[model samples]
Target: MRNLLLKLSPFFLLLALFYHPVNAQNDSIKILSYNIWNGFDWGKDLDRKNKMTEWLKEVDADVIGFQELNDFTPEKLDAWAKEFGHEYSILLKEDGYPIGITSKQPIQLKTKMLGGLWHGMLHVKTYGIDFIVVHLSPHDWAFRRKEAEIISDYTQKSVLMEENSKLMVLGDFNSQSPFDVNYDAQNTFSLKRKQLSDSLRRAKNGPDAYQNLRFGSIDYSVISKFLSLPLIDVVQKKQADHNKKSFPTLVLGNNLSKSEFEKNQQRIDYILVSPNLENQLIHAEIINQGTPDILSDHYPVQATFKYIPGK
Candidate 1:
């Protein structure tokens, strides 16, 4: 009877352990991608700046990426990030294209793989978890191909070789999803694109293999295809809105007017992560879409994720 009681004791202890509150820590991360409308030669947006501040304050994300940065100085962006209690920022003002990233935790920049025209990779890790923040060009198709080549080259030569490095290419990629089959006539949610084909063309010559993920609506598949890395999109798993269009903002202030910006529609922003990191993705969203504050002309996109344990 005592032996039976002792065996039951272990089972009950296990149950009690599950019930403990101390084990509540999550392995996921909260990430935000904002094309903060800055630098563009529009009517100076003081009101919009305040709106941006308020919006960002409400977001409460762990990592943030901002685009269209011809105006905001690195010092100013750093100051703004500081307002959010963020300790790190990487803002550039070169070319019509500048991108920046801010994080509460320190990001170890893989400087070799980052910035030139496109922000390639900002490597960061928190508590044994690893990530690489990437911002791609948001241009027409032909130009996209050129940028894609650059990014693909950088990724192959740079990130894949790193030990345990989980890559995430998240930001505006300008090109539509026509290259992907997942979207109907309206190409919105697809991870795979023509870049996948381009990457495949070079795979045979590369040291490692690759996968093209346009097979799915989520960006994880695209990262899986391009980098040959293991990962998936967690937001799609918990949500049923598979057809949700990643409606990019219409550029309203410059040569692009309100109607011009509203005319064409597609999901330009993305979050393509390593395959192993997909299951950890918890949530993602497009911020302040309907309401336009002239922060550049595009809406900000953000994602939350957890670093899964034991595969």
Candidate 2:
């Protein structure tokens, strides 16, 4: 009986070496950030939502941070998340334009700030990483700057608390990145400022709007603050050469002509990570293919990071 058991041990060892639990062999986690265009067009387009679900399943990200979840409740988002294989979800608030986080792993809400921010910030912990999802003010650069300062203060405190913290801050900034030099070279900044001025004049809020636009419409202070936190911009770092335009995608309800859209296109969505996670970053992209291009006015940004055990 002892000899027989010894012979079977080799087969058991072989099986243990060959089998792994699901993604155990893959030491990477994919994080995605997207503003789902007013909650999948205000939750009125079911077909679009279905298509988006399919797309999410295909992406197979470990976690996703969302902005502009205007009409989503926690239950509604949970149901949608299950369809795409996410078992855990959390919403910032039910009223106004809320943000959310959904993950394949369990999510623990750390912070939800709604009083001082424009759209608000939703912070959660999952897979041992901290994610702060934010949507800063869209109409005023100065307001966005203030919001960025608040976020910076919070993030700095978190970083100081732990030397090896794995943290990320990402979402629709609604402001242009200073890293995208094309905006200045192509005069896109001036064009957008002119467009803003025209709209404000039409609304008869020209003076106040002009005062807010004093910084010349294309402000870098918001993004610069995050950079100052020493967080790495994953998309900028990985896809440095590509045209990373993430906004004004071809949507169902927009009147912008092809040329107009091209001129107005900018990369507002982002996925930023702590410097500690920089070496683990394998791939980062602004998703532009297939359903994403037509599903929302803003394209999603994704970053893949290799998991380090016991970090």
What are the clash counts of all predictions, listed in order? 19, 0
Tens-digit per-residue lDDT, 272-300, candidate 1 = 66665665666765553555434546666
TM-scores, each model vs. reference: 0.64, 0.87
Off by over 4 Å in 1: 1-27, 40-43, 93-95, 112-140, 178-243, 250-263, 288-296, 307-311
Off by over 4 Å in 2: 1-22, 187-190, 198-203, 210-214, 252-254, 309-311
Model 2 — TM-score against the truth?
0.87
Residue 178 lDDT, candidate 1, scale 0-100: 31
Tens digits of per-residue lDDT for model 2 on 169-260? 98999877779866544636445755677476647864555333434455677788898888889988878534687876877326665556
Per-model C-alpha lDDT, please? Answer: 0.54, 0.81
Q: After superposition, how far is residue 311 of candidate 2 from its true place, in Å?
A: 5.9
